[model samples]
Target: QQQKCKQYMSAELKIPTPHSDCKTACILLGQSLKSDLMCQFENHIADFMDGLIEESMILEAAPVSAVFSSSLSDKERGKLRHLHPHSQGKQFISRRSLLDELFEVNHIRTIYHMFIAALILFILSTFVVDFIDEGRLVLDFDLLVYAFGQLPLVVCTWMCMFLSVLLVPYNLFHLWCQSQSSSHGKSRLCSWLFGSVYLIYQTLGLGFLPTYVVVTNSFPPASCFIIILEQVRLMMKTHSFIRENVPRVLTWKKDKNPAPVVPQLSQYLYFLFAPTLIYRDKYPRNPVIRWSYVATKLLQVLGCLFYTYYVFVRLCIPQFRSNSLHLFDLRAMVLCVFNSILPGVLVLLLGFFAFLHCWLNAFAEMLRFADRMFYKDWWNSTSYANYYRTWNVVVHDWLFYYVYRDFLWMSQKHFRTVALLCVFTLSAVVHEYILAVCFGFFYPVLFCLFMCFGLMFNFIVHDQRKGPIWNIFMWTSIFLGQGVIICLYSQEWYARHYCPQKESSFLDFLKPRSWSCQRPLMADS
Candidate 1:
């Protein structure tokens, strides 16, 4: 009926009816483009339907290939029929449209797998709970706890390996399917980064420490280095096929085509060591990666120098001899702070920046790539929002996909704020666990609570009109709250553990205009 509507519209507006020459073009354009059609026409009911009636919209939409299949003129459909060869009863769907529906639009297989995984987890958890409750799984509490605690890590490792090999290749195939002209340098880049990181970590035994005692009761060489190297070797072979074939499999227009595949392979390798993919889509032309990498290495060297200086001061210099030693008073601690935080943070920040640079560049490339090859408007009007979302998307993707998405799905519309609060709390709890493992203290829980309240408050009651000021206030409150708790908690721990009097009040430290700020000796003293 859309055809009738177009005719009605033409008559009503006194515009000439579409020429015979344009009909084939219109049909091809309509059929080849589905997303743009839906995005443009989803809300318009008049063109779509009426009660108990499906209206014929236009001359049956035909494929682009069908339009160009025959030498016949647009005035003759009968002559073109033999060359076109499409069945009259069948509806045409673009190959891109079919892949999109299966993988992107519907996510049918993903949903099915998730359901199966959830059921298995449920059953296992139930059996474990029952076994523990009945005392049938007999073991000492510590051993049992340690073994059970590893379950999540084991499951995560299994899933990562599965997805790395299976889902990654599947995503690569989608990239191949979508790339009509370009050789999909971006997709290959993503695979390289992931593969490189996986290999590096695996070679390092994922940062695990193992001890082996020799005959002389001396420590054996660290096994972690060997494991990591082995994993890296495996990964190289696993990715060899993609490394060799990607450039040849896809075609590209000459000007738009990438340099010889070797340079492209090198670029992918660069990203593998230090990912450019995250921000590559955002800022492909930027040289921030090289400078950032240099700066990080410089900081690491500086950190090592500081550490050596600290050791020299403590061991070689006399204690309490002179104020001349700036080394012990402040320089040592400054060095310690740098040694504590900078190396890891610098690497993380570099990754974050790379993610931003790559994502925007890739997105821009994607738009141009789609426009030149597909000749369809697949890019969303909310492209800016999408760019922001993809910029440093790895962590947020995990948060949204695993936690927030599931929380929202389960809760529907009810208590969304509460569900979000729980998610924050859960994140905080995991962070606290990590903190406790690294440092022999349970004090990080207070920081976790601080984050929970801050996130919940900002999310539930944020005011857009005062967004900047509101953000400042929220951040200040969280920092101050955490700072106060940490200070008090540390002082309390010190007093209880080392300071003579465990019960001294703050007032006792400031009594009766005492010339000495130090507390008086205890009665027993």
Candidate 2:
């Protein structure tokens, strides 16, 4: 039987007699036995030989032989099929960002050096001006200090949010899972009751508690930002946990014979702190935590903070400080817009570096999470579409998975455009909400730019326009958009402060004070 199997395998596979082996024949036969092929050849030796002859004839009739198909294109050879965008899988083992690899190149390293040089020049210029104007080189960081004030309260709030996030989701999910496994009616009912109560508690703790603190204490913008950002992070983390695990619990409830797999609390806790937004049972991790690298990233974050302070003080503050509302004509607006471009771009870059790179990398290293792809080469993108998808990959991943992809699935893949619109709308609303909450106002400048101009650009200047000019256009748009946001928001911010209304009303609060800062001519007369 073994000899006959070997002979059949050799003839079917077109292997030479000299190279034919029993082990290979046995493996092939084992596979066949596990499949329907075994049934066709089960009758006799004649049947097996007939099947092999048919297979060989089919192989010979093919246009291209597998052994000599090098002339074929990758598509023809089925080699590049996986390269298709939809064919690619969403989740995989983590890898470093493209910029991290580029930093190893000499040319890319030069760019880093250039940024350092610019920082040094800014420092020197500040010192020289201080010495010349005041006959002293005293450095004041009062703005920076004020921006980051109320640290103890912020820390306490963050700790409270973190504890709630760490404990609530896991415990609720655990209870649900246990209830799913239970056979008794009373136990299941009790579990449901406990879960409902726990969820309400979580809602109040995660949502209302933070907002109450921020509103009651009249937290500064920066301090409010800390609480709001933490709230967002914890909410996202909890949603991800529920999204990933709940279906499994439901599935297990249906099939109660086999035990369900539940991830450990340690794994969930680790995921809460991990840089990536996706939840997983386990993630690729580094063998050792690099303390030096962590320290360097932390320092870079600090440098970025200082960089933002300097840019605002030198470029933004002075531009808006002395300008009266009556003097804010078209010329003033144009000048302010142009002047804001440099500082706005600098702030954008510093923010991208500080949070996406430095802050994420620091946390990733500390946690030994090997995947560090927090961002991509968004600068090189020629379209706003690509820019949105590539920039802030962490958020993009979550939005794509939870919002875009899930919407498509729910809609049975019919409403693709609607799904995309939903994504854009959600993103725009979230951005506007964050800004409104942080700034304590309802300026929808970001919303207008994002939903209107940004959405238009996404379709108009798309990924198909692959040229240097298109890239330049995209960058120009980015600079102008940033300038407009900085200029208009800064102006409104100052206008509110300098020209407070006699009595605060909802209409007055919602109104843009910058537009009506100067009283009516009749009132003045």
Candidate 2, 1-525: lDDT as tens digits: 556666565555533366778887777666655443543455476777876765555444333222111123333224222222232223434466566778899999899889888888888888898899899996888887777788899999899889878887788778777776556786578667866776786578887889888867868888988898888777878888888887777677677658777889999999899997888887778899899999999999998888888788677776776566664599988988898999999999999999999999999999989878687678988878789877888888888778887887898877978988998999898788778777767889999999999999989997778889999998999999999999999888777777778887767757888887763222110
For candidate 1, the lDDT comes to 0.36
The per-model lDDT (C-alpha) reads 0.36, 0.77
Tens-digit lDDT string for candidate 1 (236-310): 433443433443444443445653232233333333332211112111233223445345445534443333333
- Candidate 2's TM-score: 0.80
Report the Cα lDDT for residue 465, model 2. Answer: 82
Off by over 4 Å in 1: 1-393, 410-415, 444-448, 460-468, 485-525
Q: What is the C-alpha RMSD of each candidate to the true structure, in Å?
A: 24.6, 10.1
Superposition TM-score, candidate 1 onto the true structure: 0.30
Model 1 Cα shift for residue 264 (angstroms)? 18
lDDT for 198 (candidate 2): 64
Candidate whose lDDT is highest: 2
